[model samples]
Target: MRKPLLMLVLAAALNGLTACASAPSADLGSAPGVKEGSTPSKGSTLIIKDFADRSITFPSAPQKIVALANGEMDIVYALGGTLVGRPTATVPAALQAAQSVEQVGSTHGLDLEKIALLSPDVVLGNHPLNTKDIPGVEGVGSKMVLTSANSIDDIKKQIGLFGQLLQKEDKAKELTQAIDQKLQELKTTPSTAKTRVLMVYGAPGTYMAALNNSLSGDILVSAGGENIAADYPKLDNYPQYAQVNTEKIMKSNPQLIVIMTHGSPEKVKDGFMKEMQQNAAWSSLDAVKNNHIEILPADLFGTNPGTKVVEALDLMSKRLQAAK
Candidate 1:
C-alpha cells in the first residue's frame, strides 16, 4: 500500500513538473482539444505574452531547450540558460558556438523530424512564428513555450522571467542590473552636439530605417545622435526601402552619415554608399563633403533596444566625440 501511494505521488509530480518533449504545432491550444489563450496550470507554472503577442507557460524549470527565435536565444544567453538547439538563422556568431548546442532548422522553415530527435523539453519562439505552431513544438511528446521580448523593457522583464524558469533568478538580476547601469551611463553622458546621423538599414538590395519607436531609431536616440529620418514615423522589415528623393537627404544633410549594413562592413560601401557618393545631388551634403560616411555591423544597431542598445550607445558616442 505504501509503495502504491509513493508511485501515485511520483506520477503526479512528473505530470505537473516534467517538461514536455515534442515539436511545436499549429493548434497549441491545450494538452488535448483545449482553446488558445487559456493555459493549464501545472505546479509553479506561469503564462506570459511576448512582444509578438503569443501565449506561453512553463511547467517546471526547463533544462534541455531549443530556441526558434534569435531574440529568444538572446534572452536565454543573457539569463545563462543552456540551449539544446537553435534555428540556423542569422543569430549572432558568438551565440552559435556554444558547446553542445545544435542547429535544428532555420527560422524560415521548421524540421519537425530533426527537432523531434533532439528531445527538447521546451521550445522557444516569438513574433511572426509565435502564432504558427509547428508539429515538433506542440506534439504530445513536447511542450511549446512562447517568449516575449518586444521592447527594451520587455527584454529586461523576460531576462528575469527566463532566470526564474531556468532556476537562475540571481544571475538574471545581476545581468539586468548591469544592462540598466550601462544604459543609464549612456543616457547621462552629455551630448556635445546633436550630430546629424543617417542610420541606413536593410540589405543593399533593399534599404530602410526605423522611425519613432523602432529599435534602431531608439538606439540612435540613446547614443546622443539625431536620426535624419526621425520624421518618417514607422517601422518596417529588412530590405524595406524608403525612397527619399536625393533632395530629402540633402535637406537633412547629416553631419556624419553612418551607413549601417548587415554582414561585412566592407559591403556597406558597395550598396548605398557607392550610389550616394556618385550621385550629384548628394555631393553637397556635409557627410559627403567631409567623407564622414562609416559602416558598422547590423547587430550593434539591430537587436531590440535591450542591453545590446548599450553597445550601440558606446559606438555612437565614440563616433560623435570623434566628429567633434
Candidate 2:
C-alpha cells in the first residue's frame, strides 16, 4: 500500500511540471499590442494636429526626431529635445552641435534613403516638402508632421504645439513669454518715422521680395515700418515672396532697403549696390539717394527668425528709427 501511494504522488508531481511547462509566458515591459521593449511604460499616446489640419496620433512621445525646417529645429532645440537628424547648413550657431547629428536634408529637398536608415519616429517639415515624398517616409514607418509659421502668432502656436508634443510645456511657456515681453516692449517704443521699407532676400544671382505674408515682411509691419511689397503680386509657386522687379522697386521708391542674405553681408550689399549703380533708374530711388540700404544680420533674417524674432524686431525698429 505504501509503494502504491509513492507512485501516485510521483505521477501527480510530473503532471504538475507538465502543466507549468505548457503555460503562456508573461510579456514583460510591454503594452498590449505594442512590441516588446518598443517604448517605455511612462510614455503616453498623443494626438497632434498639424498646420495642414491633419491629425496624427503618436504611440508615444517621439524619441527619435528629424526637423527639416530651421524654425522647427530651433523650437525643438529650445525645448531641450535631442535631434536624430537635421539640415546641416541652416542650423543656428547656438545649435551648432546638432551638426554632429545625422544630416537628413534641407527644406529644399530630402534624402529619403538616409532618412529611412535613421528611422526617425517623427519628421517635422512644412508644406514645401513634396506630398509625393510622404509615402517614402511612411514606407520606413516614420510619421511626418507638417508645420508652418508665417506670423508671430503662428510661431507662438507652433511653440505650444512642440511643447505639447515633447512634454516640455514649461520651457515652451518660458520662451513664448519672453518673446511676448519683447514684442510688448517694441509696441511701446516710439517710432522715429513711418518709413516705407522694402525687404529683399538675396542669393548669389537670385533675389526675391518678401511680401506682407512672408516672415520678414510680417515682422517689418509689426515693427512699425511699411512693407512696400504688400501690394506686389505674389509668385505662383512661391506665394510668400514676389519676383523682384526693378521697375516696381523704382516706382515704390522705398525710403529704406533691407537686404537679407545667407552669405557675406558685405558681399551681398556690394552686389546689390553695384546693380543699383548700373541702373540709372534705381539710382533715383529715395533709398539709394539717401544711402538707407542695410544688410540684416543673417541669423535674424536669412531664415525664419525662430525664437530670436524679437531681436529681429528690435533691430529693425532701431534701424528704422535711426534712418534719415
Q: What C-alpha RMSD separates each model from the true structure? A: 9.3, 15.3
Predicted structure 1, TM vs. truth: 0.75
TM-score of each: 0.75, 0.81
| Candidate 1 lDDT by residue in tens digits, 166-192 | 767678788778768877887788756
Give per-candidate clash totals: 16, 0
Error of 2 at 39 (Å): 19
- Tens-place lDDT per residue, model 2, 212-279, is 88888888888888887898899998788998777778887888999999887787778767876676
List where candidate 2 sits over 4 angstroms from the true fold.
1-42, 264-267
**Model 1 misplaced stretches (Cα beyond 4 Å):** 1-49, 52-55, 89-100, 134-136, 148-150, 233-245, 304-307
Provide the lowest-lDDT 10-residue window in model 2.
29-38
**C-alpha local distance difference test of each model:** 0.62, 0.76
- Candidate 2 accuracy as TM-score: 0.81
Scanning candidate 1 in windows of ten residues, the lowest lDDT window is 26-35
The per-residue C-alpha lDDT of model 1 at residue 241 equals 30
Top candidate when judged by lDDT against the true structure = 2
